[model samples]
Target: MNTAAFSSLPLNPALLENIASLGYTHLTPIQAETLPPILEGKDVIAQAKTGSGKTAAFGIGVLSRLEFNRFNVQALVICPTRELADQVCKEIRRLARFTQNVKVLSLCGGVPFGPQLGSLEHGVHIVVGTPGRLQEHLRKRSLRLNHLKVLVLDEADRMLDMGFEEAISDVISYAPTHRQTLLFSATYADPIREISKKFQFKPITVSIDSSHHDSVIGQHFYQVDKARRMSALGYLLAYHRPESTVVFCNTKRECQDIASTLDNCGFSVQALHGDLEQKHRDQVLVRFANKSCSVLVATDVAARGLDIKELQAVINYELPWDPEIYVHRIGRTGRAGKLGLALSLCTEAELPRVKAIEDYQGVAAKWDEVAPFPMAYAERFQPPMVTLWIDGGRKNKLRPGDILGALTGDAGLAGSAIGKIDIFDDHAYVAVSQDSVDEALAWLKRGKIKGRSFMVRKSQWG
Candidate 1:
């Protein structure tokens, strides 16, 4: 049966209608291939990459089988990182739109455990979380999966590579033996197979060729001396001048070093790593997404679960040992039908890794020379907006509308002059056009938001 149109599937009519309303016209290759066995209550091992609609493939299955009234967790989705877990939970919520009263919760590290425990106590139908944090909850007896109907290991390969095998195993031990298990990964490697063998019950295998993104992503590789890779990265940035870019680093230390180096050199850059606190991480992401920062240097783990629209480029500061990881890193760009640029800085010692990527993709890489960063390209790469920090946020009853009203209303600024406004517990960050910074700062300094005067200052980034 052709399941191309979502209506053709055996999903709830409301789900089908909801998807149609959400602009899902047809099934993605992964969804078309995997949803059938999944909806039939069978375990599945699917080989699909990110942005391949794998989340929806598993999400729909989990939503369909959910017993909302049961309250206990009926399905559990484990991701390698918090960002991915949050994304998966959101996808599940969207799919469950028609399923009334369905509750989906996200559990991950770097968040307040108290809030998670409260949400658990209130009851939830599905739980999406990282292995380590999920294990912590289970150990505290705060999360129970005894009634779990489905267990999903999203990005199982990356989870194992990140050394979550023991945690994952411990989480699975708490689930009932009769439940369905689904493993989804970008590659069908030995570890993935091993995970499937241990967790899945005669799981039907589905492999979808996900080279579509490759067509839209323009990939280039450049050979540089080890010490000159950072210089090459700066030159590439100035030459390409992508509005939003993610620079991939092999380690947390490297991410921090590159971010600091680029910051000192006048590039608007932010570093994302596991070592960052949740609050600081949130601020960095907000700044990058709101256009206050132009470049984000992130390790693979820290970069996981980030979904940015219209991302123009991805720079590989260092090549990964695993070819699959290379694919994953470059996949962050070239999304939403937009053309993307992927630039990799390779060294003499990393030639084998480059070849491994070529063999994995079955295509010769496009090699290019490092373009010299002439003075003409210098001004083209700076970020166009600056972030303003407000000391008041949700805790102080500060809303985005209040801030916007303060700026465009009392401050007499145009609505178009403002970018994204992110509100957190005790602070908010607003992006303002560089041209209006002086006026914005002056106006904000004297203005009152929501009828109350609060201290405001321009955010200083390094």
Candidate 2:
């Protein structure tokens, strides 16, 4: 089941080693079925849910076609969101870990264009990005598509659902005429099939978990009054006190309201919706994924490619119109060899939707009563100990170790005194204990990391 097993599938020894280093001994169903055709240079259409190992499925094939010495963009993976682009690029980088000079760039909107243009100018071998920004780069001549060998449209249906058809088609039209077109999605409706027909040439199709069966997740039903659903959610959180949880609402506004209510109740919580600035959305996700925030309230679209490893539970604050969304939401948990809990707060009016989910799963949910939420019966908002902002990150060759060394060395602060450190593409965020905020700031102002100075400032969480 190791990379050695896949060695006969026409991959190099270095790639095999890289796969081993990534702790992937054997391929998942998606990888096993899709890798061979892709490695044989055939176009593939793969359907798999999140965390089903599709990233590595296509990543290996893309990396196998690359020549380390060449700097041209050989493979272009277009993801629907910036977060997804970043995630895909990270996976590609890992698959190409042993190879020297494998430069993977993620181009997305809301990030600084200047840096991306500069990176493109320097040269890149693989590019992963969102449709709009990729098209923008192509128009500006910053991203050339002539050398493209493989074109991957990840989350293809989501792109169509999000109305990225024009942007995706535009980017595709610019790519070379004879390139491999690979499309990956959770479901392949007529729209995706039509796009495949238009763009892909007799591609091989691989479907895993087509029924969207979710067995690992423990389903629980919480019956509450229409007005007291929020109270029931609060009670469940206090009762279970899961390490991390995502509460899904039917609308963006409901997500905001729930997050605000939780924050007011003294919980480390954040809301992810379409209305927030991209930067804030990124920060909210980082906080929730890193356990800096205990709860994340989000709409389905905003929560779509979120892969939190230790996610303990999922709460259906509002029932989705499509019962399939119920399966996708709960599937986020009960992953990576851990048990997951899926709870739904249902009112009398939503009985049909609730029944649909239960019938689909072929299992009945255990009903529960209104238990006491030993939760924070607290009053109002309290300011955090200290907010951190780092103006330098991966592009600047900055890392957590360097930041830690700088803070402890130049700032003369104890390691335990630092609260949290969240690193992004061009910036990082660190939190210092309230007691040492003044000293940390005063010292960092004069200190340097890797002999280079960066702008460090307090964060505005509100």
Model 2 Cα lDDT, one tens digit per residue, 119-155: 9999999999999999899999999989999999998
In the order shown, what is each candidate's alpha-carbon RMSD? 3.0, 3.5
Poorest stretch of ten by lDDT in candidate 1: 372-381
Q: Give the per-residue lDDT digits (tens) of candidate 1, residues 1-462.
A: 234788888988888898988889788888898999999999999998788889999999998898777899999999998768877876888878886799899999887889899999999999999998899999999999888999999988788878999999999999999999999998898888988888889999998865534568999999999877878998998778887999998899989999888777777889999898877778788888888789999998888767776678999999999887888888878876788999999999999999998888888889999965432323445688889999898879888999899889999899999998888768899999999878988888887889888888888654
Clashing pairs in 2: 2-25
Model 1, residue pairs in steric clash = none
lDDT of 2 at 284: 77
lDDT of each: 0.86, 0.82
Candidate 2 matches the true fold with a TM-score of: 0.88
